[model samples]
Target: MTSPQPAETRTQKRSAQTATLAEIAREAGVSAPTVSKVLNGRADVAPSTRARVEELLRTHGYRRRRAESTRSPLIDLVFHELESAWAMEVIRGVENVARDAGLSVVLSESAGRLTPGRTWADQVAARRPHGVILVLSGLDESQRALLTSRSIPFVVMDPAGDPGADVPSIGATNWQGGLAATRHLVDLGHTRIGAISGPTRMMCSRARVDGYRAALETAGLPVDPGLIVTGDFHHEAGYRQGLELLRRPDRPTAVFAGNDLQALGLYEAARELGLRIPHDLSVVGFDDLPVARWVGPPLTTVRQPLMEMAEAAARLVLDLGREDRSSTATRVELATSLEVRSSTAPPREGRDVAG
Candidate 1:
């Protein structure tokens, strides 16, 4: 006797036919209600049964017809991590749009992962929200496919990595911000300038660092590798790296801290070394957070409109969900500006040159 054919082979035989829920349930050796549970992302289904049903559904190219009435009155906002004032800005922006649309907001964190977990995709499908706004996060192919199969729309805001051309994304002009921050320091006659960069894995961080290099090259200054240090965009990294940079014998007369937090950390390091801001050393920073202005001497930094970017992402995702059409302008980058304050000035006398 021949062994029973594999599910794939049996499914392939009926590939020409439009697969129904009953057919999928039969193929997976489960009841119709079990298949329905899997389709609805109900947690009651067993993992093994759900996996089998999902595979059969994918194999059969099953697509559940979407009805606007079936969707929940909520907008899902996902973040890579929920730490810092940076996250608060994004939350406020998303909330503003959700409130206007008469929809409640559901927030989730990926816990530092750039891509949310598989369980999140299932939960989202079950919830069937109006749309999803992902901040500093992207979706994997499987997650994307799951959402697409369910007709759920998603938009990425300031993606930590390249979110592919087909994925809609909202971002700030990070390169321009970096350029402006460094140029401001250069214009103040600081030649030996150091830079603190955020994680290179993030496109935004890389772009900002590139802009910093461009500003130096354009102004006829050498880009010293030794003067550039990497950080995790946190105050602790800033303080730790700041100490390392400032302790160098040929320390930069001015330094561009990657973000406001790092800049604050750098301030502490400068104080410990008896180097006063804009007096013995000039400092520039990015992401002019609220604390940037409240610091002892206001921080000279680049202002990225985080809330505005978040609002744009939320709006775009809702538009996509309602229109059910791909937008012509899928990628949007908001402008960033330099916020000049008392922290930067002409490098104190001879401090302009490396000593």
Candidate 2:
């Protein structure tokens, strides 16, 4: 017989166009066979290991994958609106994860309705996507029930709460983050602190407000009802809330906002009123989103692990479709941190701290 070609050369050439198991293995710090086990949808791979492989592929952009279909990952990404910088970043994170795994995505809006059927569900069902990823604001029992009844895999990026605790959830640690923001303001020795909050329907809005109130109580100061103003958590809401607070004769010396967007608006509102930051009034905010640092007087706020949380949530939901593993809804909670910067300090010259 003629001399045979080298096995390694042949194997490498055959893999020229697609992401090979060896590539994933090296990225994941595992052997090629282990990569095969995961691609085969085997339960032998641990949850953490599976997450690592998925993350590596996602970040590295290893596409052209044609693994056996474990409920084809045609993902449906339902979002509120992509206009807001914060919302857009979350959607981007979700998309990055879905695309890297060689999956497709559908973007939908669940406006007015409690659930997505008329607005999104029916559309996603028609498309027959492998799974659904919801970035919902608030949902009632009827909406939650409808989603729960679906046999298709689903994950949620709550702008509010986990109405259906049974489904896997990934979101910023709003409560802790809020606390950190409030404490930063308090640390500067500003006690007569007020807060402008996001929509009440949002869990983050409520959690952040609660965190502010708790900080005051811990400092032995009664939470002032008059000092708290509620808003929609948008820039305009921030501007409007800022004006309301600024106009008051007994205005707050320090203010904490539910989000960075709102805080930036508040900053503008203060400037219009001839007030200087950290001098006339101190301000702190939650969600140290990308735009936070770029604004005038860099914001001191709480940072949500937005990208990492999105990836984790996406993987958890996708895993449900894999037949090789025991199908159960999983939950993963990520933490947040306080990022102090140029936007906070003590009261004006004559203003009493206790007031």
Local distance difference test, each candidate: 0.87, 0.70
- Tens digits of lDDT, candidate 2, 34-152: 76554444567887996686555434434423224434457877666555677677777778888898887777766533355543543443344566777754444433433332335
Name the regions of candidate 1 deviating beyond 4 angstroms.
Answer: 1-34, 56-63, 324-327
Residue 31 alpha-carbon offset, candidate 2, angstroms:
49
Candidate 2 weakest ten by summed lDDT: 142-151
Evaluated with lDDT, which candidate comes out highest? 1
lDDT of 1 at 141: 76
lDDT for each residue of candidate 1 in 1-355, tens digit (9 for 90 to 100): 1244577865664563477778888889999888878877899988988888777776666766667898998999999999866999999999999999999999999999889999899999899998999988899877886776676888999978988766889999999999999998888888899999999999989999999999999999999999999998999888899999999999998899999999999999999999999898888888878899999899999999999998999889988886566567878999999999999889777556655
Candidate with the greatest TM-score versus the true structure: 1
